[model samples]
Target: MTGRPNDWLLRQLPYGMLSEDFFVRFVSIFQEQAGTLLQHADNLPYLADVDVTPPAMVRHMGEWLGMPGIDTSYPAATQRRILRTAAQTLQWRGTVRGLTHLLELYSGGPVHVTESGGVYREGAAPDDPAWAVLEVDSTGPLSESDFLALVLDEVPAHVQVEVRVAGRTVWPVLAEEGEMAS
Candidate 1:
């Protein structure tokens, strides 16, 4: 049987520092995983009124409300506003941080992160204030296989976590396979 949407979403959580190439792969994987989760969660109730809009200053450049044209209709306007807010809330940084927070909670461990940006360390502490959200830890090295395994094991007993780690994602492992030092 397939895993529940909530369970699947929680398990595909992304964790660890990524190189430039690795980061790109992470983004791709995250989008895929999140898309799947959303698809499975389609039955959930959603507010009818929501819209996204851009600030007037940037209007000259033509802001895309995630569609082809300006949404002037009442429903469209509401959707635009909601979309903008949700977009901001689910920024790349926010999404990554959220995934990290989820990892910590699932692992029942304090995430120690070591990354370039302050965003990675956003709400990380021994006692995370955002318990329900994912936390990013930048302190230590995390292997891709282990990361994938962590996610795979967390899902409810049925669904499989199909993680496709790019060669660049686990460069060290590839290098070792190529007879390079460990």
Candidate 2:
């Protein structure tokens, strides 16, 4: 299925079959439908591609990826950008790197994720709960509150995080009906 079609009819057809008029006509009709189906099959991967997928289908892809903060209000371009990094986001869901990657896709700028309680050692005493510092430029497509919500979703619930946007520290926001993030 991954390789080229190498059936005998396609690879080494007999000359006698080519000369039969009825055979040729019947096969031509069959080939027309088969070719169309084959072409669709060949392009099936493009449907999954965030860059080339149709705008209407991109939202469905978001659902398949289980990417949070997706909404119909966000522009198709923003949705694509978020979907493009869904794999990386899912892969690093709970760590600093995962949160950083997802925000970077939205901000298109440098995102800093620094945490203070991750050093491990043998027989070392367990430290108090960890805290994370998330810093990003707020001049991106995402509004500040929406951006913060995404950060909360990616971060572990037990870990306390402080977000600073454009150099101003942001306390936790209790947004009504959590807003959408790109």
Candidate 3:
């Protein structure tokens, strides 16, 4: 996991742009982890192949990178491990309260962090699976560009929102999800 593109970075290309530092370092990490994933994939072989989903690959890389608690028995635990590793490396935690605050603005929804550190919108309970199962560690390390894409994808449009960062607030052009959901 030291010198190669891990599976997560490869999958994220379809999602949005990445900064040069992020892109380069992540690719290096990904490349370093690919061989380990291949070996481990042959061992337990969760997916049909090593390079399927971004999140899955990240988990695989975490296993090789020695990320703690990454091999949790629960699905949510596994997600959490991947997220935490990515967040720490990317320096995303500073934005947690900010992201939560932004969610409140957009949805007019209350926001709070779960005991495990995942964020939830107003009306979401601590036990809610969205918060419980999401494994929010990576949200901590996200770059401004990546964070914006996350907000656009993660936030529901029916709720009003205004995301603020670095003292600037932004009202995003919400996407249509109703038809898509149906």
TM-score for each candidate, following the candidate numbering:
0.21, 0.63, 0.27
Off by over 4 Å in 3: 1-42, 45-56, 59-80, 83-141, 173-182
Model 1: per-residue Cα lDDT at residue 103: 51
Using lDDT as the measure, the top candidate is: 2
Q: Which candidate's TM-score is highest? A: 2
lDDT of 3 by residue, 12-60 (tens): 5644545466876767686667766666655465542333444556566
Q: By summed lDDT, which 10 consecutive residues of candidate 1 come out lowest?
A: 131-140
Q: Candidate 2 residues 66-174, lDDT tens each? A: 7654767778888787787876578777877778887888778999888875757786846678888988887377777777777777788888788898888774543
> How many residue pairs collide in each prediction?
20, 0, 19
Off by over 4 Å in 2: 1-45, 73-75, 119-125, 173-182
Clashing pairs in 2: none
Candidate order (lDDT) = 2, 3, 1
lDDT tens per residue, model 1, 1-182: 23445434334544432335666565667777877767646533332223222333123222342222222342444435434443453333233353345355333346433322323465563343222211233212335555544443433332212222331233223454466433
On a 0 to 1 TM-score scale, where does candidate 3 land against the true structure? 0.27
Q: Decide which is better by lDDT, 1 or 2.
A: 2
